[model samples]
Target: MAVLSEEQSMLRDAARSWVQEKSPVTAFRKMRDSGVDVGYDADAWNEMAEMGWAGVIIPEEYGGSNFGYLSMGLILEETGRTLTASPLLASGLAAASALVLGGSDEQKSEWLPKIADGSVVATLAIDEGPHHRPEKVEARFEGGKITGRKTFVLEGMAANLLVVSAKGPDGIGLYLVRADDGGVKRQRLQLADSRGAANIELNGAAAEPLSGGFELVEKVLDRARAGVAAEMLGAATQAFETTLDYLKTRVQFGQVIGSFQALQHRAAKMFTDLELSRSAVEAALTAIDNDAPDVAELASLAKAKMGDTFHLVSNEMVQMHGGIGMTDAHDAGFYLKRARAAEAAFGNQAYHRDRYARLQGY
Candidate 1:
């Protein structure tokens, strides 16, 4: 029911066109064939930076475009359509959220401009394991030195700056640590999606404490969850569209499988699921912008629903495409792989659903 403004629509359309032209399925195939782990194209990343995609949600004073979260979501959706590989989710959204919510003036002045310009890659290191419970953080900071291990850090191997979550004397705090710090070590994790991540080992790594306390960390997590939900929605939307296109073109025994009643019904159901997921994602974005009291709950709900939607839609997309969907040669498989990875990226469906239920006092 929510309508984007004219400018917003234009921005979304422009991103879509750029992705289609520059970062198409052929590019993904090439990356996969070359055994590239991250699947990122440097030229495409620069193009995105030039188009202000990196600064969509950053404030104006920070050299960003200052568009807001909705615009960021729109761009994410377009990126999903192509399965374009980049650190947009980790650097552009997660790191930016942390900086906006908790960084000091000096921290902001030092990092935000570089991030807005895409000159630096950053990511948040919070999950110490497969289970993402920040409150259970065991990473320790003592005397301005951090020592701990963080697992499953998205884009961890590539980030220039890491906003690390640690247990301070008072409570949880965000610490800014440069990746090149002497005591820091990063081990690349070979994930199923071909996206880059790592396990970071910190042994007395020098860190600058962020300004806020646990409350600010919680707020940043909320924003990060909302941003991830938006990205999941993008993946889900792309999966549905990809399946729809395949159904229309691929012939069956006599005609296009899309014309069959059963296939049509399945497509309709997938579309419905996609729209429902979109509504939840949009609600989360609005809650974030307005600082709604239920923002956390809405974010969990959106993430949970979109996680389920992505799984169902991506699986269906593959099934509808038959054997070709399982082969790496087809674009459908790429979307499926990305969707499965993203479903578990920030939090899986059951994880967020339980969080949502707890938030609702269930």
Candidate 2:
């Protein structure tokens, strides 16, 4: 396990307690059943902002705590543990990442404060293809207007502002567009985990250009992957923990299944996998914090490893739970569904594996 500083440890503890008490797994089920348009509770988001989580990575001058990305990752891990559904990652973290890396003074002055206060819901619209392909951004930007379609945009259904990527005369550029602008259209997607997403089509939408453009887009993408990897780590750990609890109490063939040698071995393997994933995610977050030269490669490595590990752990959780696990009434299945969604979020294990190899020049 990675050693945490006093502050990060406290943040993790506080986040875990808050999620458990205020918005546990049951809250997610309620939201899904409620058939709400946003698919998340507004009260929970405000509570998170009140807790200073919304500004965990933003600069203090801009109404943020400026604690950095590692601090943000700690909070994400806690949220992932309970399958808490919120735009904290999609809007708060990912959108904030783009602004922090690329936003000019005027842009930051106007948007950061609102983002920090949870008043403005923002998201990234980078992938312009049917899948996760940053290189496939073919959206057009001409004469200060954007025109193209982006798919699988996280939190796109509920965003008021969008950080869109388009091919400009210079190169791939990042442009900010108002979600309700005249030329924007969105179609909500039904994800496996019920986390909200959308396909957006932009037609001659006016935009404000971020300073760093493509370079900043790369940085933001790596940071987003690292954040998602941390969340996956938490979910995998939780699933393993839940399965362990079930094994201890569940009876099988006149004995507790956990007491059996075969079952004990499976538990041990899961524990080891979870620990390995923890190490990779922690390394990636630390690399980003220090501005390490190899941060990009580390992010890809962590994402691939964590996604695969979570897929493994979540599957085992369902299997170990036996028949009850297959039923919708059981929470074990939720973890598996969430794992599937997250695994495919930024990129799946296969996508990142290829990315890691390319980064290594293999």
Candidate 3:
């Protein structure tokens, strides 16, 4: 486990209290069932912003606390515990990082403050295909216009601004495109996790150039991956705990299932993996904060490890609960769905495993 500063500890505790009391799994179920176009409770997002969570990484001059990556990760972990649905990750962390790292002064002045205060929702519109291949961007930025389609855009339906990756005159570059542009069209996707996503088609929409080339896209993506790994750690931990509770209570052959050696071994394995995953996740987040040269390597390590653990724990959770876990009424199904969706997001275990080895020059 990572050591926490006084403020980070307070922030985590407060987030825990609020999520437990106000935004539990039950609340998530409600939001999902409502079929909200935005895919999150607008009121809950406002409350999170009001608490300064949306600005955890933004500079103080831009109306944010400038806490850094691990600080934001702590809050994300808390939200993952309850399956909270919000644009905080997409807009607050990912898009904000792009601007902070590569945006021009004018661009930062326009978008950073709005993102910090939740006045606007902005997200990265990269990955033109099903998988997260940032290097395969086919989107074109020419003549001050963007043209191409981006698929599986996080918070796409709700974003006011898109930090888009496209091939510019100087190789692949990041551009800012307005969501409401004349040539933009979006189709909402009803994913199993019920999270907000869209397939966006941009046909010569007016675009504003940001800064940096593909390297900026990579730096922003590394931050996003680390943030996702942190969330996976929380979900995997919670799933294991939930399964453990079931094992302790569910009886078979006149004995508690947890007393069975086979089940006990599984539980031990999950506990060990969860602890290890936490270490990798925190290390990745810390590397980002320090701007460590090995951030990509650590980010891939964390994401791949956490993805494997979450996959194992979520599956075990369903199996341990028997028929009840398979039902829609039970919360186990929620964790399973979220685990699969999250595993695919940013990158899956397979994807990161390859990336990690490549980073090490293996």
TM for every model, in the order presented, reads: 0.96, 0.98, 0.99
Q: Residues 300-358, candidate 3, lDDT per residue (tens digit)?
A: 99999999999999999999999999999999898999899999988888999999999
Return the lDDT, model 2, position 298.
92
Error of 2 at 223 (Å): 0.6
Best by lDDT: 3
Q: Which stretches of candidate 1 lie over 4 Å from their true place?
A: 37-39
Model 2 local distance difference test score: 0.89
The per-prediction tally of clashing pairs is 0, 0, 0
RMSD of 1: 1.5
Per-residue alpha-carbon lDDT of candidate 1 for residues 1-362, written as tens digits (9 for 90 to 100): 35888988999899889989998768866765676545476677888888888888788899898787878888887787777788888888889988988888888989988998889989989889887777878899999999999998998887999999998898889999999999899998887777778999999999998878787777777777777777777777877887888889989799998999998998999889888988988988888877789988888888888888888888898899899888876777777777777877777788888888888889
What value does the lDDT take at residue 42 in candidate 3?
97
Question: What does the lDDT read for residue 10 in candidate 1?
Answer: 95
- Report the Cα lDDT for residue 83, model 1: 75
> What lDDT does model 3 reach?
0.92
User: Residue 197's C-alpha lDDT in candidate 1?
Assistant: 87
Task: Return the clash pairs for model 1, or none.
Answer: none
State the lDDT of candidate 2 residue by residue for 1-362, as single tens digits: 56778998999999999999998889999988887767688899899988888888899999999888888899999999988888888777889989988999999989988999999989989997767888778799999999999999988888999999999988997899999999999999888788888999999999998877688888888899999998888888889999999999999889999999998998998888888888899899889989999998999999999998999899999999999999999998889999999988888889999989998999
Whole-structure CA lDDT of model 1: 0.84
